[model samples]
Target chain A: MSTPLISIRDLHVSFHTQDGVVKAVDGVSFDVMPGETLGIVGESGSGKSVTANAIMRLNFGTQVDVSGEIIMNGKNLLEVDDDELRTLRGRQMAMVFQDPLTALNPFYTVGNQIAEAYLIHHPKATKSEVREIVLNAMVKVGIPEPTKRMDSYPHEFSGGMRQRIVIAIALVNNPQLLIADEPTTALDVTVQAQILELIGTLQEEYGSAVMLITHDLGVIAETADRVMVMYAGHAVELANVDELFETPTHPYTVGLLGSVHSLDDSSRGALQTISGTPPSLINLPTGCAFHPRCRFELGENSLCRTEAPQLHAVGKSRSACHLPESQLLQIGAKGGV
Target chain B: MIYFVIRRLLFAVVLLFVVSFFTYVLFTALPTNPAALTCGKNCTPEVIARNEVRLGYDQPIHVQYGRFLKGIFAGRTYGPEGASVHCPAPALGYSFEYHECVTDLITRTFPVTLSVAIGAFVLWMGIGVGLGTLAALRRGRWQDRFATTFSVVGISLPTFFFALLAILVIVIWGGLLDFPQYTGFTENPIKWFSGLLLPWATLAILSASTYVRLTRNGILEVMNEEFVRLGLAKGVKRRTLIIKYVMRAAMVPIVTIAGLDFAALLGGAVITESVFNLPGMGKLSIRAVTDSDLPVLVATTLVAAVLIVVANAVVDILYGFLDPRVREKV
Candidate 1:
C-alpha cells in the first residue's frame, strides 16, 4: 500500500462531562493507504467522526482527552504542537464536515472563503495566484461559472451546491488525505448521489486517501475499498468491503446487514431489527459491548457475558465475537448474509 | 439597500409626527393655566388676557397645533403686538422660564450631551466587549465567574448612586481625579477629555457590566455554532476564527442594544449629567420639566424620540449588513 498515508494506532478519545466520562472513541486502529477509500460505518455515537477529527487534532474542548498515535506523513499528529497542526491541517490534510448548512462560514463569499483556505498556508502566494487556485478548485468541484458564482454567499447556493463549496474548500490545497464525515447525510437523495460521485471524481483527480464516515452500509458498498464496522466506540469488524458484506463475522455486523437486506426483500417477511439499543459508553456492559444485543448460539454461554472479546482473525476478516467460525457460517446462512 | 433606508426614514418621519402630536395633545390636556403662569401671580385680568393672546393660548387647540407644525417649517412670532419677537425656521417657540429660544437652548446643550454620550460609549464598548470576550474564552473559570458577578452588580446599581460613589471615592477620598466638568472639545481637546474622564469612567464601568454579560453570552453561543467549528477545522488561525467568525456573529445582538443605548444616552443620562454638573441635555430637560417650560419640554421630548427612531433604523440597517440572509429578505 506504499506506506499508508495515515496510520491511526490505538486511538482513544473521551469527553469528561458532569454525568460521566464519555468514551467516545476507544482503541480504534486503521490505516488509509494512498488513493484508497476507507469506509467507517457506524450508527450515531459510534465515534467515527471523533476518530477522523482526531487525525487533524480538531476535536478539542476543555474536558476532552485524546491519546495514541495519528501518524500522517511520518509525524504523529496527536503529539504535534498546535502551530504545526494548523500548518499540516489544510496543506497536508483537510476535512469536510457532515452538515453543509453549517460547514461554511456564512459571512464570506464562496470565492473569498476558498481563497482564505489556500492563502493561510501559502501566505506568500500572490493575489493573482490565489484567485487562480481558488477558481480552479471551484471548477474541479463542479460549481458553474467559477468567476460569477464565487461572489455568491452560502445562502445563495442550494444544499447540494453548498456541499460542493465545502468540498472545494477541503480540496483547495490538494491535501493528500481527505476526511469526509457523513458529507452527504444532510443532502437530498438525488443530490446525495451527485455529491458522492463528485467526491469520488475529486479523490481520483487528487489521488488523496479518503476516509468516508457514514452509517449507510449501502454507501460503503458503493464507495469503500475496505470497510470498518464500529459499534459502541469499538471496531467490531474489519475486512475488504466485499468480504465483510459477503460474510460478516461479527454478530452486530450481521444484524446491521440483516436489518437493511430484510427491508429490501420484504418477501422474506417483516424487517428484522437488532433487539436492544446500543449500550451507554459511560457504563458499558461487562462483556463484549454488543453481547446484550447479539443473536448467536454461543452468546448464551457465561463466557460471552463475563469476558470481553478482542478482534481476532477469522478467514479474510477480523471479528470481535466469541462465536466460532463453524457456528457463524451456519448463522450467516440462516441470516441471509 | 438604498430603497430600504429611504423607506425606514419615511417611516421614522411619520412616527415622529405621531409621537409629537400625541405628546402635544397630552400636554395641552394638563389643565394648567400656562398663560396665567406667564402673566405672574399678581397680574390683573387685562394682563392675563394679553398674555393669553400673546402666547396664542386663546386659539383653538387644532389651530395651535397647526401653527406649531408650521412654525417648525417656517418662521413664527411671539410677545405682545408692540414688541413682537421673531423665531427663525425650525423654531420650537420660546421658553417662558428661561426666556430664551427653545431651539437655541437645545442646540447649545446638545453638543455637551453628545460629547458625554460619545466618550462614555467608546469607553463602555471597549471595556464591555473586551471583558466579555475574555470571559467567554475562559468560560467556567474564575474570570468568567468574576465577570458574571460584576455584571449582576452593575445592572442592579442605580446611576445616581454610581455617580455619587465615583465622586466620593475618585474625587474626595482618593483625589486621583478631578470632578467632572463640561469643556467644549473644539476649544481645548485635552481639557475636554480630562474634564469628562471621571464621568466617562463612571458611565463606562456601570454600562460595561451589562455589555460584558451580553457579549460573553453572545460569544459563548456563537463559539458553539457549527460554522465556528468549521472555521477551526479549516485550520484558520485561532485569532482569525474568533474575530471573523465568532465575534462577528456575536456582534449582531450586541450592536442592536448598543445602538439604542447610545441614542438614549445622547438624549441625556439625566442623573449622570446632574451629578457631574455638565449642563448636558439630560439636565436641561429636567430643568424644563421642573420650571414648567412647555416649549422646552416638548422640544426635548421630540428630540429624544427622533434619536431613538434613528438608532432603531440604524440597527436594522446594520443587521442587514451583518447577515446576508437578512439583506436578501429586506
Candidate 2:
C-alpha cells in the first residue's frame, strides 16, 4: 500500500479533568495509504476527533496525556521534538478544521492568513512570490476574483467562501497528508456537497492522502475508500466502504446502518435506533463498551460480560465483538438486531 | 476613515457646547455671589455693585452665557474704558479666585495633570499587560497565583490609602526617595520623573489591577479561540501564535479601556494629586469647589468634558486599525 503514508499503532489519549481521567482515545490503530481517503466515523465524544488531533500533536501542550507511535515518513510523530514537529506539520501534513467562521483569524485578510502558513514553510521566499502563491491557492479553491477577494477579511465572506478560504490555507503548502475534521459540519447541506467535492478534487490533484473525520455516514459513503467505525474510543470495525456497508459484522456497525434513513426504502418502519446514549469515557461499562447498548441477547456464560472483545477477522472486515463469525454473519444478513 | 473622524470631531464640538452650558448654568444657580467673593473682607454694597457690573453678573443668565461664549472667540474687556484689562480671545474665563485667567490656570495645571497621567499610563500598561501576559501564559502555575494575589490586593486598596501607604513605606520607612512633588518635565526631566514616581506608582497600582484582570482574562479567552488553534496547526511558532494571533485579538478591549482610563486621568487624578500636593487640575478643581469659584469650576468641567470626548473619538479611530471588521463598518 505504498508503505502507508502514515501508520498509527495502539494510540491512547487521556485528558486529566476535574471529574477524572477521560480516556478519549484508547488503543486505536490504523494506516492511511498514499493518495487514499480514510474515513473515521463516530458520534461526538467517541474520540474520532481526538485521534485525528493526536496525529498532528494538537492534543499536546495541554492537560492531555498521549502515548503511542504515529509513524509518518518513518519518523514517530509522538517522539519528535517540537521544532521538527512544527516543520513537518504544515510542510508534510496540514489540517482543515470544522468551523470556517472561526478557523480563520478575523483580524487578518484572507490572503495574509493563507500567506502566513506558506511563509512559515518558505520563510526566505520573497513577498511577490508569496503573493503569487497565495493568489494561486485562492483560485485553486474555487474562489472567484482571487485578487479582489484576497484582501477581504474572513467575516466578509459567506460561509461556503470562508470554508474555501480555510481549505485554501490548508492546501497552500501542498502537504502530503490532509486531515479534515468535520470539514463540512458547520456548512449548509448544499455547501457540504461542494466542500466534499472540493476535497475529493484537491486530493486527486495534489495526490495527498486524506483522513476524513465525520459522523455523517453519507459523507463517508460518498468519499471514503476505507471506513473505520469507532465506539467509546475503540475502533469497532474497519473495512473497505462497500464491504462494511453490505456486510457489517460489528453489532455497533449494524446498529449504525439500521439507524440511517434510506430515502428509497419507504416500506421500512419507524427508523431503528440504538437503545442508549454513548458510554461515558471516564467510566465505561465492563467487558464491551458497546454491550450496554447492543441489542443481541447474551446467552449464559457469555464472555461478552466478563472479557473485552479484541479486533479479529470476521468475514471481509475486522470487528471487535465476542460473537462467533458464523452467528455474526447470520445477524448481518438479517441487516440489524 | 477621514470622514468618520471628522464626523466624530464635529459631534465632540457640539457635545462640548452642551456640557459647558450645563456647567455654567449649574454653578450660576448656586447661592454664593462671585462679585461678593471677589470684593474681599472690606467690601461695601457700592463696591460689590460696581464689581458686579464689571464682572457682567448683573446681566440676565442667558445673556451672560452668550457673552461668555462670545468671550471665548473674541476677547472680553473688564472694568471701565481706559482702565480695561483685555482677556485674550479663546479665553475660558477669568478666575477671580486665583486672580488669573481661567485659561492660564488650566494651561499651567494641565501640564502637571498630564505629566501624572502619562507617567501613570505607561507604568500601568507596562506592568498590567506584562504581568497579565505572564500570568496567562503560565496559567495555573505559581506565577499566575502570584499575579492573582497581587491584583486582589491592589483592587481592595483605595487610591488615597495606597498613596499614603506608599509614602509611608517608600519614603518614611524605606527612605527610597523623596515625597512626590510636581516638577516641569522640560525644566529638569530627571527631577520631574523622580518627583512624579510615587504618584505614578500609586495611581498605576490602583488602576493596573483593573487592566491586569482585563488583560489576563482577554488573553486567556483569545488563546482558546479556534483561530489561535488553527494558527498553531499551521506550524506557526508558539511565540508567534501567542503574539500575532492571541495577543493581537486580546489587545482590542484592553486598548479601548486604556484610552478611556488615560483620558479620565487627564481630567485629573483627584485624590492622588491632593495626596502628592501637586498643583494639578484635580487640586485646582477641588479648591474651586471649596471657594465657590464658579468660573474656574466651569472651565475645569469644560476641559474634562473635552478630554473625554476627544479620547472617545481617538479610541474609535484606533479600533478601526486594530480590527478589520470595525474598519469596514467605519
Candidate 3:
C-alpha cells in the first residue's frame, strides 16, 4: 500500500470544558493509503470531524487533550513544534470545513485565499507563479470563467460555488492528504452530486489520500472506497464499501442502512429508525455505549451489558459486537442486504 | 457611491436644519431676555425697549429665525443706526458679551479644538484598538486582566478628574509633559504638540477605555468565525492569521465608534479643555453660557450639530469601505 500515506494509531481527543471533560474522539485507529478514499460516517457529535481535525493538529493549545501517534512519513505530528507543523499542514495535509458560507473570509477575494495556501508553502514562488497556481486550482474545481470569479468575495458567489472555492483553496498546495468535513452538507442535493463528482475527478488527478467525513451513508456509498462507521465516539464497524453494504456486521450499521428507503425495495413501509439519542460523552453507558439503544442483545449472554465489545474479524470486515457470527449474519440478511 | 454620498449629504443637511431649529427655539424660550442681558443694569424701561429693538429681540421668534438664516447666507448689519456693525456672510450675529462676531470667534477657536480633537483621536484609536486586540489575543491572561482593569478605571473616572490627576503626575510630579497651552500648529509645530500632549493623553485615556472593551469583544467574536480557522488550516502564520483575518474584520465596529467619538470630542471636550486652560470650543461655549452670550451659544450649538452630522456621514462612508455589503448597495 506504499506504506499508507498517513497512519493514525489509537488517537484519542478529549475537551476539558468548564462543566466537565468531553470524550470527543475515543481511541480511533485508521490508515489512509495513497490515492484511496476513506469515509468516516457518523451523526453529529460522533467525532468524525474531530478525528479529521486532529490529524492536522487543529485543536492544539486549546482546551483539547489529544494523545497517541499520528505518523506521516515516519514522524509523529503530535510531537512536532509550531514551525514544523506550520510547514507540514498545508503542504502535506489540508482540510475543507462543513459550512462554505462561513468557511471563507468574506473580506478577501477567492483567488487571494487560494493563493494564500500556495504562497505559504511556496514562499519563494513569484507572484506570477502564485497566480498561475491559484487560477489552475480554480479551474480544476470547475469554477467557470476562473478569472472573473477569482476576484469576487465569498458572498458574491452561490453556496455551491463557494464550496468549490474552498475546495480549490485546500487543493492549492497539492497536499498528500485532504480531509473534507461534510463538504457538501450545506449544499442542495444536485450541487452535492456535482461536488462529489468534482472531488472524485480531482482526487484522481492529484492521487492524494482523502478522508471524507459526513453523517450521510449515501454520500459514503458513492465516494468512499473504504468505510468506518462510528457511534457515540467509537468506531463500531470498518470494512470495504461493497462488503460492508452486502453484510453489515455491526447492529448500528444495520440500523443505519435499514433507515434508508430505496426505490428498488420490494417491501414498502415506513423507514425503520434507531431509537434513543447518542450517549453523552461525559458519562457514557458502562458497558457498550450503543447497547442501550441496540435491539439485538441476546437473552443468554449478558456480556453486552457487563462488558464492552472490542473489534474482531467477522467476515472480510471487523465489527465491535458480542453477537455470534451466525446471528450477526442473520441480522444483516434481515435488514441491510 | 455617488448616489450614497448624495443621499447621506442630503440627510445631513436636513438633520443640521432640524438640530439648528430646535437649538434656536430652545435658546429663545429661555427665561432670561437676550436684549436685557446685553443692556446690562441700566435703569430705564425706555433703554430696555430700545435695546430689544436693536438686538432684534422685539421681533417674533420665527422672524428672528428667518433673519438668522438669511444672515448665514448673506452679510447683515446688527444693532441700530450709528452703532450697527456689518457681519459678513455665514454670520452668526454679534456676541453681546465680547462685542465680537460669533462666527469669527468660532472660526478662531475652532482650530484649537480641532487640533486637540485630532490629536486625542489618534491617541485614543491607537491605544484602544491596540490594547483591545492585545487583550483579546491574551484573553484569560494577565495582559487581558490589566486591560480590563484599565478600562474599568477609565470608564468610572471623570474626564476632568483624570485630566487634573494626569497633569499632577506627568507635568507637576514627573515633568514628563508640558502643561497644556494653545499654540497654533502653523506658528510652532513642536510647541503645538507638546502643549496638547496632556489633553491628548487625558482624552485618550477616557475614550480608549471604551475602545479597548469594544475591540476586545470584536476580536474575540471574529476569532470564532470559521474563516479564521480556515486561515490557520492553510498554514498561514499566526501573525498573518490575526492581522489579515481577525483584526481587519474586528476593525469595522471600532472604526464606526471612533468616528462618533471624534465628533463628540470636537463638539467639545469641555472638562478637558477647562482643566488645561486651553482656549478650545468647549471653553468658548462655557464662557458664552455663563455670560448669557446668546449669539455665541446658538452659533456654537449649530457648529456642534454640523460637526456631529458630518462625522456620522463620514463614518457611514468609511463603513462601506470596510464592509462590502454596504459598499455594494450603491
Candidate 4:
C-alpha cells in the first residue's frame, strides 16, 4: 500500500474552560492516504472538528491543549515552528471552514481575499500573475463571470457562491490535503449537494487527499472511501465505507445506522434512537463511554462498564466494543436495535 | 452621493433655522432688558425705549426673527438710518458689548478652539487607538489593566476638574509647560503650539479614555470574528492579519464616534476652554450670558447647531468608506 499522506497518532485535544478541563478529543488515531477521502462522522462535541483543526495546528495560540503527532511530509506538525507551519499551511494543506458567510472577510472583495491566499505563499508573484491566478481559481470553483464577481463583496453573494469563493481561496495554492469541516452544514440541501460535488470534482482534479468531517451518514456513504465513527471524543469504529455499512460492529455505530430513516424500507415503523445523551467529556463513564446507551446483553464478567474498549479487528473493520464479533454481526444483520 | 449630500445640507439648513429661532426666543424671554443693559446704569426709561427702537427690539418677535434670518442672507442696518452700521451679509449679529460683529468675534476666536480641538483630536486618537490595540492584544495583562484604570479615571473625572488638575500638576507643580493662552497659529506657530499644549493634553486625556475603551473592545470583538480566524488559517502573517482584517473591521464604529466627538469639540470645549482661560467661543458665550448679550448667544448657539448637523452628515458619509455594507445604501 502507498504511504499515507498524513498520519495522526494518539491525538488528544482538550480545552481548559472556566468550569474544568473538557477533553474534546481523547486519545484517537487515524491516517489518510493520498488522493482518498476519509470521512469523520460524529455527533456535535465529538471532537471531529477539533481533530481536523489539530492537524493544521489551527488551535495554537488559543487556550486549546493539543498533544499528539500529526506527521505530514516527514515533519510533526505539532513540533514545527510557526514560520515552517505557515509555509506548509496554504501550500501543503488548506482547510474549508463551515460557514462561508462569516468565514470570508466582509470588508474585502472576493478577488482580493482569494489573491491574498495566493500572495501569502508566492510573495514575489507579479500583480498581473496574481490577478490571473485569482481569476483562474474563481473559474475553477465554477463561479460565474469570474472577472465581474471577483470585485463583489461577500455580502453580495448567496451562501453557495460565498462557499465557492471560500473553496477557491483554500485550493488556490493546491495543497496536497484539504480538510473540510461540515462544509455543507450551513448551506441548503440543494446547495449542499452542489458543494459536495464541487469538492469531489476538485479532489479528482488536484489529486489531493481529503479529510471530510460531517455528521451526515449519507454524505459519508456517497463520498468517503473509508469511514471513522467517533463518539464522545473517541473513534469507536473504523472500516471501509461499504464494510462499515454492511456490518457495523460497535453498538454505538449500530444505533447510529438504525436511527437513519431508510426510504427503501417503507415498512419500518419508527426510526430507532440511542437511549441516552452523549457522556460529558469532563467526566466520562468508566469503561465504555457508550455502555450507558448500548442495548446488547452483558456477558459473564462483562467489562463493558468497568473498562474502556480499545479498537480491535472484527471481520474487515475495527471496532471498540467488549461484545463478541458474532453477536455484533447478528445485530448488524438485524439492522435495528 | 451628490444627492445625499444635497439632501443632508438642506436638512441642516432647516435644523439650524429651528435651533436659531429657539435660541432667539429663549434669550429674549430672559427678564433682563438688552436695551437697558446697552444704556448706562444712569439711563432713563425714555432713553431705554429709544435704544430699544434703535436695536430693532421694538418689533414683534416674528418680525425680529425674520430680520435676524435676513441678516444671514443679506446685510442689515443697525441704529438710525443716517448713522446706521451696515454689517455685511452672513452677519450673525452685532455684539454691542464687544462693539464688534458676532461673526467677527467667532472668526477670530474660532482658530483657537480649532487649534485646541485638532491637536487634542490627534493626541487622543493616537494614544487611544495605540493603547487600546495594546490592551486588546495583551488582554488580562498589566498593560490592559493600566489602560482600564486610565479609562476609568477619565470617565469619572469631570472635564473642568480634570483641566484644573492638569493645570495644577503640569503647569503650577511640574513646571513642564506654561499656562494655556490663546495665540493665533499664524502669529507664531511655536507660541501657538505651546500655549495650546495644556488644553490639548487635558482634552485628549479625558476624551482618550472613552476611545481607549472603545478601541479595545472593538478590536477584541473583531479579533474573535470568523473572518480574522480565516485570515490566520490562510497563513497570513500575524501583523498582516491584525492590520488588514482585524483593524479594518474595528475602525468602522471608531471613525463614527471620533467624527462626532470632534464636531462637539469644535463647537467649543466649553469647560476645557473656560478652565484654560482661552479667548475662544466658549469664554465669549459665557461672558455674553452674564451680560445678557442676546445676539452673541444666538450666534454661538447657531454655530454649534450647524457644526453638529454637519458632523452627523460627515459621519454617515465616512461610514460608507469604512464599511462596504453601508456604501451602497449610503
State each model's CA lDDT, in order. Answer: 0.86, 0.90, 0.88, 0.89
lDDT of 3: 0.88
Estimate, for each residue in A174-281, the C-alpha lDDT of model 2 and write its tens digit: 999999999999999999999999999999999999999999999999999999999999999998898878888889999998899988888888988999899989
Residue pairs in collision within model 4: A287-A307
Model 1: pairs clashing at backbone N, Cα or C within 3 Å? none
Q: Tell how far residue B287 is off in model 3, in angstroms.
A: 3.0
The digit string of per-residue lDDT tens for model 2 on B16-108 reads 888888888888888888888765789899988888887889999999899889989997766544555668987888876677878889999
Give the CA lDDT, 0 to 100, for residue B315 in model 1.
89
What is candidate 3's lDDT per residue for B1-330, written digit by digit as tens?
Answer: 778978988998899889988999999898877776555575478877787888788899999999999999997888767888899999998886887888889888899899999999999888888898899999989999999999999999998888888888888999987677889999999999999998998899988999999999999999989899899899989999999999889988888888888898888889888899989899999998898888899999889888889999999988888887678866
**Candidate 2, residue B197: CA error in Å?**
1.0
Query: What DockQ does each candidate score versus the true complex, computed on alpha carbons?
Result: 0.73, 0.81, 0.76, 0.73
By summed lDDT, which 10 consecutive residues of candidate 3 chain B come out lowest?
B35-44
Best by TM-score: 2
- Candidate 4 per-residue C-alpha lDDT over A98-203 given as tens digits, one digit per residue, 9 for 90 to 100: 9999999989899999999999999999999999999999999999999998999999999999999999999999999999999999999999999999999999
Q: Pick the candidate with the highest DockQ.
A: 2
Q: Specify the highest-lDDT model's number.
A: 2
TM-score to true structure, per model: 0.95, 0.96, 0.95, 0.95
Compute the lDDT of residue A185 as modeled in candidate 2: 98
